[model samples]
Target: MSATALPAGHALRRPVLDDLPEVYRLLVAHDVSVLGFPDLTEDDLRDEFTEPGFDPVTDGWLALDADGVAVGYAWACRKGTSADVDIDFYVHPDADPGLGGCLLTVVERRAGEIGRELGHGRIRAMVGCYRVALGEAALLAERGYTVVTTFHRMRVTLDGDLADLADLADLAGPPVPSGVTVRVCGTDEDLLRAAHGVKEVAFRGHFGTVPQSFDEWYGHFAKRSSTDWSQVWYAEFDDEPAAMLLATNAFVETDNAGYVQALGVHPRARGKGLAKLLLRISFAEMSRRGRTSAMLGVDTNNASGALSLYESVGMRPVLEIDVWRKAITLG
Candidate 1:
């Protein structure tokens, strides 16, 4: 750990695996202040440390006060081989206000180096801020980042009595299409591949989507401590894979809810009620598993009518997050 241009009594250093607890505490404090609840579990933070291409040594920085207590954290992560980089910085509400700018500067510099290494002429630095955090949003605006899009964290309460697929349809949505079947995706490699394929095809042209190989997709979830393979589901139209839904234990610890990590229906399969069908199926399964609620995030401006689809299934917006972007030239 070495001191950077931090305040006279503060220092910055690379975070190590041993710093998980302290880092989690810092993050929860920040989240609680801005979002009114701790949105990330310790396992979630652990997974971030091991994300496919993230290098804890060079891509992250931790700020500490004179007493050596953690006060801020920041990191820059490149999305696959693309020029789009996701960066986040959090400062303790009581910490020095300038600490965020210092940490962000380090993250931006690292993002540039990443873009140049990948042979990109320029990079887009993006960050997500809670809509209610006016100060944080203003800081990003001051640094030339503009709000690109807004995302809503939606949730639906599930009644535990959804005894069967038939009951699910009666309770929430229409019955599955004539030839469509929905089933839990076990650990079978072939089934996993099919689900991944459906996802890649379905998410094409969506905002901020970076295409990923099957191995990349699998490895990302496999490394997450919270991944539950049984929670993954896929749909088949006429015995051909046409949609997929991936759920995780992301909200189990904090909200006693099942988090829908990804839900997608192939282009050719749209407008056939597959999305709503999958949502209802997932809700039933989560309810059966004793989860009181199901949760997912969606882009408010999604052209695919996803927001309306979720709303139709009883999911309501519980939180709003804004994605901000700033273009950086790699020289």
Candidate 2:
């Protein structure tokens, strides 16, 4: 890939694996400036660079100052089972305003190329950022993007006292309803298929739903070097799996926290309290592993009453992430 000319004092070039430290530094600095703490971890950066369907050499770009320090970074990856692409970029607080729009323009064009390569007739460019990221929100709006949805980054402390520990231990017996049982996924092929099937059923009709084969879904997870399949659990009611909770250490690795990558309850099992059961079980397991907190992101308008459920379980909103989308038109 050839370098792209940027502002007079900066140059844009393809990002390589070795650029992760500098890229992550820029991302965290931007994140902390907006959210009061770092949101992107080194592992997150690494995964983005190596995820399937994306070639860093062509899809990633970094804006560097004359001194060679990265001041901005952008990349796009195809969303599973769709012609849409998700683009994420971060600019240092000190970077030129023009750099933000420049990076976005490049990624948007790449998204269109990705769409055509995937044999899609139309494509969408989607992005997300903390609500506090006013500069990005304004830039997106100026560039014709619209706010499509909002998500809450919910969190809860797992460090419980003696009484709490006793309560959790009491729940260890059987957290689910009378006929339901919960267990971690097995490594066997059949068990993996069963777990993925439960996930597919549970997430149907959810916002931004994109159906993916088990291989694709698991492949994405496998890219995250820290993924622990043992933390992924499924709930079976009367010998039939009905719910799934996929957990990971992706975001909170340095914070000693656990993250719920996905939590879903089948429509048929909605009123059986399986969702809450899975959450409590996850919290207990995280605590057992010495994690001090648990975190997850959820759409504020989820049809499953997940917002209220999380609030009831002591999870509170720690950050607001807004999603913006616009159609892509290739030249």
State which candidate has the highest lDDT. 1
Residue 186 lDDT, candidate 2, scale 0-100: 50
> What digit string (tens of lDDT, one per residue) describes model 1 on residues 97-183?
888878888999999999998999999999999999887898899889999999999987776444433435454444676999877
Cα displacement (angstroms), candidate 2, residue 150, comes to 0.6
Task: Report, for every candidate in turn, its global Cα lDDT versus the true structure.
Answer: 0.88, 0.83
RMSD of each: 3.1, 3.0
RMSD of 2: 3.0
Spell out the clash pairs found in candidate 1.
none
Stretches of candidate 1 off by over 4 Å are 1-4, 160-175
Residue 180's lDDT within candidate 2 is 86
lDDT of 2 by residue, 4-57 (tens): 337777888999999889888998889888878887678887887899988889
